[model samples]
Target chain A: MKKVLFLFVVLFGSCAKLDNNLYNNDNKIKEYKLDDYTGEQDFILDDSYHIPPGLVTLLTLPSQADGESSSTEIKAIYIGDVSKINSDTVLLYCHGNKDHMDFYWQRAKLLAHVNGKNKYGVLMMDYRGYGLSKGKPGEKGMYADVSACMQWLKNNGLNNNRLIIYGFSMGTASACELSANAAPMLPDKIILEAPFASVAVMIQDASQLNMPADYFTDLKIDNAEEIKKCDQPLLWLHGKSDNFLNYKTHGQAVYKNYHGRYKESILIEGADHGQVPSQMGFENYLKLIGSFIRKP
Target chain B: MRLIRFICIFLFLIFICFCSPTQLVKPLQKGQRAAAITYGGPLIKFAGAPIPIPFTTLGFSYGLTSKITGYASLHTTSLIFGNLQTTVGGLFSLYEQENKFGLTVSPAIQTAYNIRNKTGFRIWPTLDLNAYYHPLQKPSFVYIGANSWFELSSLRAHNEPQANHIIPNIHAGYMLVKTKWQHQFEIKYLGLGIPNLPGVVDYIGISHKGALGIYYSLIRKF
Candidate 1:
């Protein structure tokens, strides 16, 4: 009996030690320093154009896992008037897998401009291991990162009815997970641009073979199951000409499986993955978004 | 002498309680097993951008339980597409009896050598812990457990010496076969910290590991 108890203690102690080591080895917090900087800058509007803008104040909000002693930091960018953001409306943007939030400064500025007059404060966050955020990027870590950001918004007086989540490609999974689990306080609407059904299914479609998606089971986000549970408004945008993620399989599956209050699927004929709005004319896309937001 | 005998008897009783014959009967009686192989290519980053390198993997696994019996395939990546690379591993389980449930755990560990080339090796060690429930005529079960893995290579392209990371996983799979051989699917969440690097790259951490696969196995009675 004593030996058995000793074995149990040893197992439990070893697990705790391993957890500590993982925390100690992570150096996310020591990376980049965030500050409020306002300066004239050169911005790239697209592949072929550069736009100059007046001085803009960039505030970097740091994020960390709950109850951790280490300094792993995640970065969130708050642009425009912080006071304009309230419990009625806010735009929370999640960028794609590559690059940091700094790279998307131009996009963030554009989003804020579109919102106009600080009517909707735009909050863009970096996933762990992306940009200046600390810690490794994994399924659990990403979920935690998203949850932490949501909590931060809530602490600052934001709620479901006032929140709108926008995700691009890989970020779509995180958005879906957050939306499904948001529950009693779900977001008002969710937008997935060029979304894939699930990492596993995406792989299967990409390979075009009979191989199973078990290898990706480790990275699986199960968005199909998640989307079914989301009862809020859902907007799925996919370009018909997209080659990276098959439109018929990924985006269509999501649109088909969404059992929500108001679900809509928009197929941009000549638009590619990231070029939908620009290719089809930004005016139309913006109109669609504006109308959705203004809908009573 | 009397004291030693008493101690021995006490240990024997405890062992019997935890590892009773009833716990080992059902799944072993059923003959159930299977294996599969899967391949995952290089993970694509930006659209229209060049993929650093693509990979191909093959895997095999088996399992047996009271309600379901099956095995699995061990390969580099799922038969899907993504940037992450996995080593190899398998599992087996038992669930179903008039009044009992059973489980087993197995794990695999692999490494990613370079972001450009996408190469690495793995070492996996597993453990299984399960529980059983009885509701009159049948037994329904639930399980919670962990597995540990060690990455053996560096993640950098230049072959810089990298710190080894350990991932702990927890999951629950249902038993489809009898108490001996069963069919099961488990969901595990992987967590590990980031390695020390530089700049924005430093804050980029990798810690999520999850999988959905089937398991099959066969039990032998002694």
Candidate 2:
């Protein structure tokens, strides 16, 4: 027993903690490169949705993980007049994994045009460790960062009934989590684009083996299960042929699990993980989202 | 999920290597006993460069009869991280032409259980057939074989119907025998006829189909 214990210690002594940052791609970039960026992109705006440089305001909000002092400041960008946020219908756009805010700026800008350009105020933020945000990124920190953003809007006059939360890819966890159990303010509705089912699904899909979900220590971002607890309306959009996260196993699974107030899903044919918006057509995309958000 | 990257590596290893690389294709004499250890996994671009996952396993083999060998192994790499896994099997010699060539079949079962996730026991049935040649007429030889595993559970994430059931691998290897030790090297084309791209792991495969795997083994005889 002593020898076995020694062997166990020696073998796992170097194993690192499963930090929440493992689920995010914040370490992939050293700085934020917005429109000037030229890398892999799912949606590219050809200046049609472009707002003047001053139109989008970059603001830093103080936020922290659950239980810790909320001192970490995160970067957020907003479209429309800040003075009118309290009276505005705001769309909180959470981005996918990879790089920083610049990668999803086009997507956020696209959401700003959901019901005609600049009609609904759109706010998107870089969770800690993403873009110019301080500290590192993790699951709890994600919720806190979003709560801080919503708090800022509430302080400026926005009400819960006019707030909509949207998540893409990795951002889906925060979206579903916050909506399922929001602290400062609950979103009126939730929108998920290319959302995954859960960590269990991802492991089983990639491996074809039924590795126990508990084997993954700290990584517990399960949107499929969390959506079940969400009573708010949900709008799910997924590509028919998503290679990263399969539509049949991931998106459909999440869509089917949500027993919410109101729910609808769109399966875009010939589209993969990152091609949902482009393949769905920008006009149709905006119309679908606008109609859903505009609905009772 | 970076953890998905870890799980994918483990899954890739299941198709390529739940046992030792020296699945010799030749049965040992009655009363013969040996111990073995193996290392290596499907190559992936981890932390920037291409490298094997360094999965490790320790195994023991015993000749129950002249034509039947019993073997079992533990995936120590996984055990170190809290998941306990083992593969158990028997080698049945089907045919042999003295020392020139021989055929053998190994039917195995792999089971894994996590200490934290108690009751979450998972099992997969595996089978391998190898045909080996003794080129030097001594203890050194080469072999080629096909290995496969069956995923019995029909439910995937969120109870989705599991579409895929069997994963196949084609492998070839060489073993060098010494007085009391043996050294082996093997290469496998894992998940044969299956596409292996658009994933977190950059598997080294052929035409984007199936992953190429390399393994090394050391064995001690008693």
List, residue by residue over A202-286, the lDDT tens digit for candidate 1.
Answer: 4333222222233223355667768888888888888887755667667777778888789888899877666666665655766
Docking class of 1: incorrect
Could you tell me the TM-score of candidate 2? Answer: 0.89
* Pairs in steric clash, model 2: A86-A157, A86-A158
Model 2 per-residue lDDT tens digits across residues A270-291: 8887788889888899999999
TM-score against truth, every candidate: 0.50, 0.89
Q: Per-residue lDDT of B80-109 in model 1, one digit per residue for the tens? A: 222233343434444444455445434333
- Model 2, global lDDT: 0.78
Q: After superposition, how far is residue B155 of candidate 2 from its true place, in Å?
A: 2.1
**Model 1 collision count:** 60
- The TM-score, computed over Cα atoms with residue i paired to residue i, of candidate 1 is 0.50
True contacts kept of each: 0.02, 0.24
Q: Please tell me how candidate 2 rates in CAPRI terms.
A: acceptable
* Candidate 2 chain B, run of 10 with poorest lDDT: B12-21
